[model samples]
Target: MATPATTAATSAVSVRLDALIAQRLAARALVLAASRKVAADSSGIKTSRFRGRGVDYVESRAYQPGDDIRSMDWRVTARTGRPHTKVFQEERERSVLFVLDHNPSMQFGTRVRFKSVQAARAAALIAWSAVRGGDRVGAVGFGGGVTGEVRPAGGPRGALRCLRSFVEWDALARATQTASPLSEALERTRRLARPGSLVIVATDGFCADAAAQAPLTRLATHCDIKVLMLTDALELAAPPRGRYTFAIGGERRRFEFGDGAHDGAWVEAFRRRRATFVDAARKLGIAVLPVDTRDELARSLALLGLALAARRGAA
Candidate 1:
């Protein structure tokens, strides 16, 4: 038998809570712009004729063996009697790749909505913002069998599709069957993107594989990887001593949740699976974004932006 209070709490935290989060996202604060245009620059500075990047003409040194022929300063080569290449730096187009985890466990969240819902929203915001910033935005959504696959679409329509695909994705998650491994999917993502591309990975960071560290390291080596490590606040926290038993549609189960701080022999055990996920993030140099559905999106976005900027500086 279960106490009325426990049952009430469980009932409140059921799947229906997701509806509330969706509603919050729908009722965005204000002035939500889905499109953006690049502004003309007139600082007496022009795109490099050779590189098309914002590279000022620095003095050219003798061309090294690996120097690109395309960058060869023909005039300098003729006068200096030695091959020399112009150097240019990129001041433009930021390509961003967003990876989403549509895993079964993500389908569950104890608070407002599922972590999947939050993950989708975060991905959508980043995708839209990237496109808005004149950066190409692409997404690879998987979990219930690779729901949406769009590769760095450019323009307002592309951003809209990113949002729409997220909203339209089937809510069902497949916990069964031979699902794709994160490693293979990561490899595929690497193939689609080039170095210096921003890769945002959204996942609970849990896989059945015994060795999760290796693949993540490999992923980091190829791209500027940022991890949106998703988890519920409560799940990450060790709850007060308690127990739960429940029945749903017929099947019944029980769980013990607590921190054994109540007595010397009692052991406090919150899943703490998120700790392992965080470890993987640190090991792989991933930028972790802890998402709470109850938190405001604007605030979260600001936090993410600052975090990203710092990460970029460090990188």
Candidate 2:
């Protein structure tokens, strides 16, 4: 018989498409407003800093000194018998790309959900938020020898598409051994992301080694990048003093857990893995947010500041 904790853990090992889709409602709380640095063009809801010579005409105003002569509204000027210039807003739909990692390392969690599930939830919420903000949603998934890509697209269609892809990719993760490296995924993302796009990477940082640095640096130059560092309570702190048993490759092993030299080393290993990833991201001007498996989805989103305070460099 399975204990309640064991049952809960089993239930959360993977995510369902409906659960991801349901996040649309919760995503409304997310604030993805545009900042001055973000670009905009045609077919976008977020107002762009640029005005003249773009799609979505705002209105015609009386001609002013130094106004672009090319923007003169001949029809309005002819009707009003006064020189007028057409005002337009560049409404380019910004792209938000999610790079999700589902390596075997993320498959373990001692809390409400696996690290992989938490990552999926975070990505889903962000994707829906992006769509609500009138931005395009795209994704790249790597791990378990499976690679999935969804092209950038806008509105519910795009959000739903990405959600479906998440489910498919996650299923693959649960069934296969992880083979793709995080560096490879980042390189692929570098190619997919356009200038002025925002890329959100969801991973446990297990495979984010030195090899991934170059790709992240290049991507940071043109794209705004955010890292969701998926973590669990077990990984963040030392376990309670006790004897822990583990089964590896069909063999059983036991180890003593306590505030000993080895215990400190174990904790430090997890810290180093997290610090290395976070430090590199910060150095490149990328924002890093830690998401825990034990957190509720809404609370997690808030903590991540999916409100994106980082847009103003406040994070």
Candidate 3:
């Protein structure tokens, strides 16, 4: 039988509006980069080596083999008697989209908080950070047979709007009894997000299986992608050597862990799922952070900041 103390602790950590709102304080200290916009012809930020026509001329560079003929710096080429190409910088306006998964599976957690709640917390921090970084923030919250979207807008107002949507959509997920696949949300994201935007996905790996890969890959081709894979310790490994029992739907069920009979398969299933997600992310040059439910909010944010920093360095 579960103790009242344990139940109370879980209740306290359930998805709450106040808890997410408080993340505003941590947002100021986030180390995420100030995003750079990309024009229609470009596939990434202006900082990338991508060439395109833009509103402002940055410089003229020696013409490379693959340099676009349309960008030839005729004046520079004539003055220096050498082939040159114009490098133009795009105007600054960035969009950061958060794809939050609140499926029924995410509502389960044996730790301090549900995976859904943890996802909400992480999304809140990132959205707030995006606003602080002067990027327009938006979100697509899907689950519970409901899909909600808030378009990208700059400043605190946009972040606040996303927070409200998070709370409302999460409530719907908790109230409903259906599960929505991660692919559905990603498909919606594809339609909603523009090229060169940054897309952050927060979810438990339950619904992130093979079916979700196509849209993910397509989305990554055009935008910067970051993933927050929320997990519980129980999902990573079998419990200590013992027999644990629980009640489900008025029936008590027993589960044995640490026994060699099934522990390997149990652990391997999770490992395989995680590997698939990692493999896909890596193939698309995306950054991924596996966040444990046991981790503090600050730790998760710090890890995310570090991941983004490393990605920026690589770029």
Judge candidate 2 at residue 275 and give its lDDT.
77
| lDDT tens readout by residue for model 3, 78-131 | 999999999876535568899988877787777777888888888888877767
**Per-residue error (Å), model 1, residue 297:** 2.4
lDDT of 1 by residue, 1-315 (tens): 879876555433332233323433432331132111111122343433233223345567788897767678999999988888887654355567887776666666767666777777667666655654566777776666665677777766666666655554434443332244566557567667755578888887664243555766766764677777776765655445677775644689865756454332222233344556577678666778766755555566665554343322322
Quote model 1's TM-score. 0.64
RMSD of each: 8.6, 9.2, 7.9
Among all candidates shown, the one with the greatest lDDT: 2
**Global lDDT scores for all candidate models:** 0.59, 0.79, 0.76
Q: Which residue segments of model 3 deviate by more than 4 Å?
A: 1-13, 31-91, 246-252, 306-315
Candidate 1 regions off by >4 Å? 1-91, 172-180, 208-215, 238-242, 246-251, 257-272, 275-277, 307-315
Between candidates 1 and 3, the one scoring higher on TM-score is 3
In candidate 2, what are the lDDT values of residues 19-84, reduced to their tens digit?
788787778755533322232322344432666444478999999999988789999999999999
Clashes of 1: 4
